[model samples]
Target: MLASPGAEGRADLKLIEEHVQRMRWHVTRSSFADVGQAPAIEQRTGFTEAFLYAAQGFAHGIVAIGRAAITTDNKAYADVLERLHQRGVFLSYLPGTGGPEPT
Candidate 1:
């Protein structure tokens, strides 16, 4: 998950963890990036690392509060979804977080 910065970001991380646990998924790794940074996935170190980790087959899914945690750019978000789909990795959003319902 990509957290913003500061206290709220920390809280978000904690919330994500709780949500993941409730869904019976284990968090083997995590990453954070400031939302203030460029929305491009390549420009965010933490987001990039998370993607790489997933690509390497270390994780089965990436969980976040919403799609915005990945990127605000529609193109970038679609690209991310495609890449994750290619890797057979899933992206999950916390319940009632305004993202698509978990499948």
Candidate 2:
């Protein structure tokens, strides 16, 4: 399914909430740079932002645990997605790629 605004960042989370299932994988609509390039906002000590990337996929769902925060720590979003994907939990998009491989 396609991702909505602020939906991509927490796509898996939202899907879990609605469907009570797990998101096996999804190709990222936007790259890590893309998400980082999204407008940054002020945090208590830093700046950050959150955006969602889209991907084509089969059956899945999500559940957001918290809010999206803008941050200068560009690696945070990518890191979370990467760790999850590497562990065979979630997947992110890549340019000109079909999608991420299941871990």
Candidate 3:
């Protein structure tokens, strides 16, 4: 799981844990960004670690509050999608977490 630092981020992580549990998915690891860090993957150590862990075949997917939790940059998000696709991993979100609401 990935989230920004602070109480809200912690809560988001908890929600992700619950979601994963509900789905019966095992969580091999979790990661979070430092406080005040940009959402870009390159700017977030935790985010990069999560990807690396997945890339290394340690996990089957990445759980996050939402896409914005991963990145808002179009190019960055595309890169992430491609990487996940290449690795046969997935990215999921809690039912009602961050990111723009579904229209």
Assess candidate 3 and give its TM-score to the true structure.
0.80
The RMSD of every model to the true structure, in order and in angstroms, is 2.0, 11.5, 3.3
What digit string (tens of lDDT, one per residue) describes model 2 on residues 1-103?
A: 2223455646643542333233334422332222334453332211111222222222221122322422235576566565445434433232223333221
Off by over 4 Å in 1: none
Q: Candidate 1 or 2, higher TM-score?
A: 1
lDDT of all predictions, in order shown? 0.75, 0.33, 0.75
Candidate 3: give the clashing pairs. Answer: none
lDDT of 3 by residue, 1-103 (tens): 7776788887877887888899888976556565675645777778788878887888887888887777788898888788888888788887765643221
Q: Return the lDDT, model 2, position 72.
A: 35
Best by TM-score: 1
> What TM-score do all the candidates reach, one by one?
0.83, 0.26, 0.80
Global CA lDDT computed for model 2: 0.33
| Model 2 Cα RMSD, 1 decimal | 11.5
Worst 10 residues of 2 by lDDT: 43-52
**Total residue pair clashes for candidate 3:** 0
